[model samples]
Target: MHIDQAILDKVNPWLEATFDNETHRAIEQMMTTSPKELEESFYKNLEFGTGGMRGIMGVGTNRINKYTLGKSTQGVSDYMKKAFPGKHLSVAIAFDCRHNSKSLARVVADVFSANGIQVYLFSDLRPTPELSFAVRHLKCQAGIVLTASHNPPEYNGYKVYWEDGGQLVPPQDKEIIDVIEALDYSEIKFTANESLIKYIDKEVDAAFIESTVKHASFNTPQADKDDMSIVFTSLHGTSITVLPDTLKKAGYNNVHIVPEQAVPDGDFPTVKSPNPEEPEALTMALSLADKLNADIVVGTDPDADRLGVAVRDNNNRMVLLNGNQTMVLMTHFLLEKWRKAGKLNGKQFIGSTIVSTPMLMELATAYGVQCKLGLTGFKWIAKMIKDFPELQFIGGGEESFGYMVGDHVRDKDAVAATLLICEVAAQAKASGSSVYQELEKLYVDYGFYKEALLSLTKKGIEGAQEIKQMMIDQRVNPIREIDGNRVVMVEDYQSSTAKNLLTGEVENLDIPKSDVLIYYTEDGAKIAARPSGTEPKIKFYVSVNAAIDSIDDIPSAEKQLDEKVKAIIRDLNIN
Candidate 1:
């Protein structure tokens, strides 16, 4: 056997003493027959990081399975008990359309119920954001959603949320990690009190969808009903359960679903990855749009939180909008609608991650609203809402596809995004324009901001070391220039300092410390680098902008700006 002695010492006892007969047999077989696989699987226990637990679904300590799920639930239950003793501790649970997701939800519910915690589990698959909403709506102490988001079919995940209907932050995250580490497999109790495990379905769904629609900018969809033709793809995930109905209820009559990708299938047989952020995931829907000459193409990931869109540019070529472009359009559309309706209350606020395009702040300033800087996640944006009740959180988003409009849900919601995107398209069409036209208008009003993302995936133990080394190298030897543009400022998020290269003066960043480095050029180009929290990858986000005076200059300006961005990327030597 090629098993490492240290790994065997840890896993052998776990199989013999801590697990059941089926798990024990599985481990024994791997140890004897697939020792290399066993060694890799059991070399180290899965680390529950800030992003919660995510891994391939299988029978191993390193993979996501019944034992790991139970242990995580038990640990969370213990923390809830300690934090809110004598209170009726409750949690809302939702699952995506992943393999064994429902079964894993049952296991999680059983653990919580056995621990005397109240569990409000959805009877069918639901989007992840609704779980965040349900936590606070039900006044639960914490929440869990079983989803891998946009991961491949072989993967599953568990996301932990707090009472505020957001992912755990700071002390609570560390506290939960401590409790989870303290639990041995022996401490997990899977026996369930079925009476305490409640099944929630239509009631919650109706309420959530109603609240989501209320976030829409259009009060009456009849005004531009004929102007929009939207093609939506759920990518065989949870959105098909409710998103189609939500759009209909929002008064969008001409909505079509990509037939093959509309069903809830764990295999996700259509796309390589269920992530809508990738253009390939929207291939079928975009093709249909081109054939029908539709107005727009919209897609959601498996868990239905993030959204991606496609539209025709002035050249009549169908193109996908990047995350930053999408956010810019959504923000401009929402605020414009509000202003027209005279709904721009004095205390309205919006938010985006620090790494996101600064153009959001500029656009918000034009509207006389505040654009607060959130740390990397939506949780921080949610935290902003909780901290400042006086300021209404109008919308917030990251450079990634995830976006949240209104605060009914603490997490990003594709249901709301899809409905609003359709409405935005309809409204633009009513004004004798397309969504592409509206985007050009936004660029004319604000500036033309072009952004691109490069993600490099590294796997296994050695892969992690390499990613860490890359970060260290960048920190030690920061870039001084890119594409003939002088690097004027360097923001080291790990140190929480922004250094002005010209002045050699460092100012502390007001956000929390993270392992990110951002480089700003003299000509208004911003580049940010950070490691992914949930996956073995590091991502570089490049944003550049040019001022546009009119819509006619969009094509040539876009071409020139794109060249600058590409040159910057090439100069940085980012793979």
Candidate 2:
């Protein structure tokens, strides 16, 4: 196949510019021997997505490499200087266990240092959320973490955080992109000011762990903790740096770490994907739990921001709880803690996403604590905290296995979330209830909600267009019904509007605009369609629920909800 001239136009500069000889040869090799890859590599420049700029690490402008990330850092540096003038600009830098993450982080630090900004670079790998904490803790102007979260081994990423310790949001993200677009590759500052670069690890780690323990630990007695065995696996990521130590400090005795997956490795050799959302990722942890007859099993993604939990059910079988289930569980436990202490005075609120189980709102309502909904990513939840200064942020989570316990870290934090979940399990067991049983009780009280996610992976160039067309098709020809249930309303987040199918009335949606759509069924079923911001796929979220009579009726109710989700998916005809 011939390489498109448009693609060649984007590629030629790498060969002729001030780039090194190695870069030129790599581009030349791709042009001659790998036309398809060359096309995908040079089709367009990588831009900030839902999480931030993330892609497979390689040589092209579209890839995550020294030059590409350097350019992004340059843009951020420029934007930071403009955003905060006459102040000494500084940034905190951290990286996960991804290949070349350490080096990539150094490059980012160099760019910021060369721009006369102070750089506080971690000497070793750290979880993504700690980077958020370090930003605010160290009093830096901004922060950057080099990680792709749960993406496969080939991927690495650059996530920017503002001074508030949250991921970069609207105006700043757009402004930085605009600055990056107008720059040439040669304009990236590659020189480092050694005097301005400081290597920090132990002090910040201590502060972060201390804060995490104080916020996440609710005084579950050491004897109560000792009564249960807990198993944890980091999935070959950065959580190993803090989770075990924090748990130990919090007085948990019987914690076992998956031997093979405990150490941080960029290859993520044990699992097919490092994502904790996938059940297969926790297989080793579950096996270890069974061997030890552990009460709970938990595993974190590569970046340690998202976590998956497994708890023993009424039948003594270990079961994996979906993201929604975990979210509701954690939120309920936190709310209960607050209620017992008389902290839920209606001035505190928790956060959930549009695709999360609606049971979170119900649980919040039971305590009279407000629950705010945001778009997909945790960045918006962070924005909610900043948006509502009058209200206190108790906790927030999404359907993708990410949760933040309080306003400390500002993003989805597994370091603290790990402790929070373990505490919930410990406390429940102390009360003769299990996490699984408490979940059923929540269903009994607030209603039973079941959720499933379908991700259709579309590869390279054509896949991008296909995903785009899929969302377009969803809007142009909206879902009207599913398995005899009538569609009562259609929500188009891209247009920031909701149309009532029954009354034909359109009302504006009060959220940031994005390329997403949701259909509400008459029976209260909701299905949302959204394209993956950082990956090459479109995702469909299915949620169905019904009131349960008692805890024993959970199995039957969930079976019905499962079939309802399947029928809805089938009626939508989404493959």
Candidate 3:
């Protein structure tokens, strides 16, 4: 394959720069031996996306490397100097157990310190949520965490956080990107200010755990907590740093840590992928739960922002609960607790994404609380807390296995979320009901909603074009019917408009524009299509619900809903 001239133009600069000799040699070697790799590496500059600026580690403008991160940090420093305007600016830096995460974090610290910014660097690896807490706790202007979340080992990311302890949003994010792109690589400040850099460990860790225990631990009796058994695995990521401790402090004593998967390893040797959402990643934990007769099983992704859970069903079978199920269970428990305390005033609210199950809305309405929906990231949910200061933010989560309990930690915190879910399980177990039974009760109260995710990965330039075309094709010719349900409306986030297909009216959607489309059927079914901002893939979110007259109707109702989803998938031709 021939390398495009535009790509080559982006590549040639790194070869003749203040770039180190080793990087120079690698670039030249790629040029001679691997043209495809060379072109891919230099095709574009890394920019902020759904998960912030992330790419494979290598020597190029498009990759995550010392020079790229240094340049970005230098840009952040410049922006902070202007945004804060002469105040003593500081940033907290944290990393996960990913390969080279520590070194990359140190490199980031060096650039910030070199720019005369005060830096509080973690003494060792820590989860991403703790960094969010640290950002607020330290009263710093910004924070950075070196984590790719649950992505493969070949991937790593640099996610930036604002003073609110959430990822950068709107004007700030756009401005930061403008500043970074406008600067040259040589402008990066790499020399460290040793006096300005301080390493922190136990102080923040203690505060984070304490805060989690306080907020996540409902009043589950000590006897029930002690009797409830839990099997947990960190999935070779950073949760081992805090989850076990948080669970222990929250009164859960019968906790079994999966031995083989407990250590922090970036390679993730024990599983095919480190994502807790995927069932295979929790194989060892599930087995341990079976052996120990654990009441609930939990596993966390790398950096610990997302968690996967398992519980006993009505038939006493250990079934894994999807993200939507977990969201419903947790949100119900939270709202019910607040109501018992007489805290469900009108000003309180819970948050979720458009892709999540609509049952959250049911629960919110039942509690007389607002259910605010955002596009597909926890950062937006975090933004809601800042956007409306008067409203009490109880809890928020998405279908991606990430959740935020209260507003103490602004980001999706699996650490705290784990404890909250365990509280739900333990309390239910104590009440002579299992998590699955409680869910059936919710289905009986609210409507039964089941959600599914279908992702199609397309790599390289050809793949990118195909993914783009898929969205374009849908816009040109939309689906009108699925499983006998007529399409009533189509919401296009890219244009911030919703078209009523039945009434032939177009209304505006009040949210930020993104390349997402959702079709609402005349019935209660909803399906959405969107391309992944971080990965080279497109995702389709499908939600189908059924009516169960009673708990006994659950088995047949579930089968009917599954068939409906299958027919919808067949109609979409998503394969």
Work out the TM-score per prediction. Answer: 0.96, 0.99, 0.99
- Candidate 1 per-residue lDDT, tens place, 1-575, comes to 46667887878776666687888888888877988777667776677553568888877778899998898899999999999988988989999999999999999999999999989999889999889878988899999999988888888999999998988887788788789888888899989999899999888888888888888647544857756778889999999988888887777778888999888999989888889889999999998898888889999999998999998877777899878878888888778776887878768888889789989988898998889986677778888888789887788888788788888888888889888778777777777787888888888888988888889999877778899999999998999999998999999988989999999999999888888999999999999998887788998889999998898888899899989988988998965
Write candidate 3's Cα lDDT for 1-575 as tens digits: 57778888888888776899999999989988999999888888887888888888888887889999998999999999999996999999999999999999999999999999999999899999999999999999999999888888988999999998999999899999899989998899899999999999999999999999998988889998997899999999999998999998888888999999998999999999998889888889888988988899999999999999999887677899889999889999999999999998799999999999999999998999999999898889999999989999999899999889999999999999999998999889888998999999999999788788889989887888999999999999989998888999999999999999988999999999999999999888899999987888899999988877899888888898888888888889975
Against the true structure, candidate 3 reaches a TM-score of 0.99
Ordered by lDDT, highest first, the candidates read: 2, 3, 1
Better model by lDDT: candidate 1 vs candidate 3: 3
TM-score between candidate 2 and the true structure: 0.99
Q: Please count the clashing residue pairs in each candidate, in the order shown.
A: 0, 0, 0
Q: Candidate 2: lDDT of 26?
A: 89
Q: Candidate 1: where is the Cα deviation over 4 Å? A: 48-50, 221-223, 341-346
Candidate lDDT (C-alpha), each: 0.86, 0.92, 0.91
Local lDDT at 189 for model 1: 92
